[model samples]
Target: MELTDLLAALVAADSVNPSLVPGGAGETEVAGVIDGWAREAGLESERLEETPGRPSVLVRARGTGGGRTLLLCGHIDTVNVEGMTDPHTPRIEGERLYGRGAYDMKGGVAAALIAARDASRLGLAGDVVVAAVADEEHASLGVQEALRNVSADAAVVTEPTELELAVAHKGFVWSEIEVTGRSAHGSRPHLGIDAILKMGAVLKELEQLDRSLADRTHPLLGRASVHASQIEGGVELSSYPAQCTLGLERRTLPGEAGPEIEAEIESLLERCRQADSEFQASHRTLLVREPFEIGQEQELVGLVAEAAAEVLPEPPKITGASYWADSAFIAAAGIPTVLFGPGGEGAHAVEEWVSLADTEAVARTLVALAARICA
Candidate 1:
């Protein structure tokens, strides 16, 4: 199938991943479409359901027996549309195909499927698998489910990497801190405790955490990070809040996992709790995506580098992904993985778009890499 048709079919399906598209049901419609497409193309495919009505699809073309198992991963979700009402439809306007998941990334998914089709047609000699899973925009439960079925020698998580070879990526952890206090009337001078005031130290210490972590650098991922994403507390306008909650993110690297970092943050909170017992504080881990990296010198990276340099007149940029992808899961499964995809900038925005030329180019490159690696 042409890349345009694949993208149009995908974008038009409205598979807004519930995580990115808050309140969205799932990408079941899109999964249904892809399921049919893969089956018709003579590829083996299945839709694995994590929860009822929440399903993910796995499609694979039979391998040439010897070299390696290549798993291609992409999410079937897009962030919810804010102001742009009909961002779901793919509209080709002046060399750009504009849609929600076009770049973040139905485009990547299309490219991988097309490349797998190309491999089957051209008789490339290795296993080519496509995992178009759900919840990548949220907790990544779909990918976690997929790992239960298939294991690969290596993987290419198809996140937008500007057509570059992504050898490393920082991990992401979502956490929340709750601070409690005694609610008091607004008119009272010292009758009730203010939760926000109690958390003043927590916020201050959170800032210190971000700063201290930023100062240290990694050779590839550079600085780790913490972001204060959300805060909520109190009900009435005039009453002192009894409780306050802060949502936070911590960017991680090879040295840490979710539980390990959770312990560190809890330790910090423990200290704060001891200093001021009135502000009893506790934290819970909302999400933990372990940080991972496969060195540039690995076989998979070298295979793509060689093919890309040969295919493109200019060298493909060698870079690390700042955002996490299913690559981490593959790496965690002991597969050497990389992030490689087409060029596009406004991913996850209302103005998101990907060039048709880039889509075709990435498809051909994936085809090349499969051929070389399998050979």
Candidate 2:
């Protein structure tokens, strides 16, 4: 099957992450569709369900052995499509293919499959593994499960990088802070403690922290950052709110200690306690993904660079992605991984698309890279 057609089928599969959007289709159907494609292409494929109802598909074209193993990874699930009209219907406009997951990215998945298929036909000395994982839009459970079951000496994450060699990207930790207070009627000011009002201090502290983070910069990723993502509090207009919860994420640079970040939050909370003895608050970390970086001299990175140099008209851009990806997880697990893929814009936005010409270029480059690296 053609790469474009395969990507269209994938985009049409409704693999919206259920965790991110209620009643979302999840990756079951899309995994099955990929499984069918892999089988028809003469590869060994299997469905892995690390979390029930969320499935990932692994398609392998085994080699003759005694050579390095390479994993081509892409996320199968996409964010919610609420306002976009016909998000699933893939359409080509100029050089781009428009669809929800096209850029952010089922295009990468399709490119990986095509590359793997071509490599399989050539009978390389090392294996080519193509993985389409679930839950990347929320938690990385699918890739986590895949790491436990499958691994490679090196990996290439096809994550919409505009065909750049992303050797580094930021990571983030999810945290939630809860401020507690006593609820009472609006008329009884002395009897009621307003948690919503108390959260003001927390927000101010977070703003300061964000500014502080900006001062710490990385050459590839630029600066560390923090932001409040969601907040909830209050019950009724007539009563003082008893509790307020603030959910936030801090983007960490490579080598930033997790404990130190926690300490920073704790110190901010301590400041609140010092301001008011009765101030009650608690902080907890929900999840953490370490930032990833690799030297451009690494063999896998150099191989892809060489391949991209040959395939692309302009020299391949080696840079850092602004967003986090499964590359962090895979690289953290001791497998050298880098992000490389076709680029478009509007990830998680109302409109999304991928460059068809660039997608084909990536597929061709991957085929050559796999042949060389897996030699």
Candidate 3:
């Protein structure tokens, strides 16, 4: 199938992440369609069910033996399309294909599927695996299951990178800090310890932390970062709230450890306590994904760069992605992984689209790279 048509079919299927939106349609239908497509292409295909109805499509072009494996991974599930108008309907205008997952990124998924099928037909020296996983918009349970089931020498996560070769990306740790205080009626200031007011001090400390992060930078990825994602406190206007919770995310560099993040939070809490003895707070790490980085000299990197130069009008611009991806998970498992994909805008926005030209170019590049490395 043509890359554009395949992407149209994919975008037509509903695959909103259930974790992000309750009662959301998931990857079950999409995975089934991909499986059938892979079978028609003569590739070995299967589904890995991580959650009850969330299945990941695994398609493989097996090697002749004694050769390496290249994994092309893309998420099947997209963020919720609540505000989108006809999000599942793919519309093509000139070189752009508009749809919810068109750029962020069922377009990349289609490219990978076609590339894997092409490699299989060529009978390459190494295997090429197209893994369309679920739950990437949420907890990434699908990629976790994929790691347990497959191994590869290297991987490319097709994650809407505007066709850049992203060798490094930030990983984030989710944390929650709860402030505790005594509740009392609005008239009784002395009787109530205001947790909401206490959180003000914590927020100030976080500002200092953010500045410190700004001073620390990586070559390709720029600086580490921290942000308060959510804050909730106070029950009613008539009373001082007993508790306030501040949700934070710390984006880590490649070598930063989880303990360092915990320590940073602890230090901030300690600073708050020093300023006000009445301040009471505690923090815990909710979740984490390790940052990914790889040297540009890796063989897989060279192959992709060479292929991209052949396929694209301009030489590939190598860089790092500010956002995290399943690439980190694959890189964590010791496989060299990079992010590469189609160009577009409006990820998680009301209107989304992908560049038809870039989508096809990425597929052709992957096909050429697979043939070069596997042969």
In order, candidate lDDTs are 0.83, 0.91, 0.91
Per-residue lDDT tens digits of candidate 1, residues 45-162? 9889967667889999777676576788898877777777687778998767888888888888999998887787766567888998888887777898999988887788878888
Candidate 3 regions off by >4 Å?
A: none
The CA lDDT at 266 in model 1 is 88
Off by over 4 Å in 2: none
CA shift of 228, model 3, Å? 1.8
Could you tell me the lDDT of residue 116 within candidate 2? 92
Candidate 1: stretches off by over 4 Å = 19-25, 185-191, 235-240, 274-277
- Structural similarity to truth (TM-score) of each candidate: 0.91, 0.95, 0.97
Model 3 per-residue lDDT at 101: 90
Residue pairs with backbone atoms closer than 3 Å in model 2 (clashes):
none
In candidate 1, list every pair of residues with a backbone clash.
none
Q: lDDT by residue for model 3 over 32-105, one digit each (tens)?
A: 88998888888899899957999998899987876788899999899989788899999999999998999998
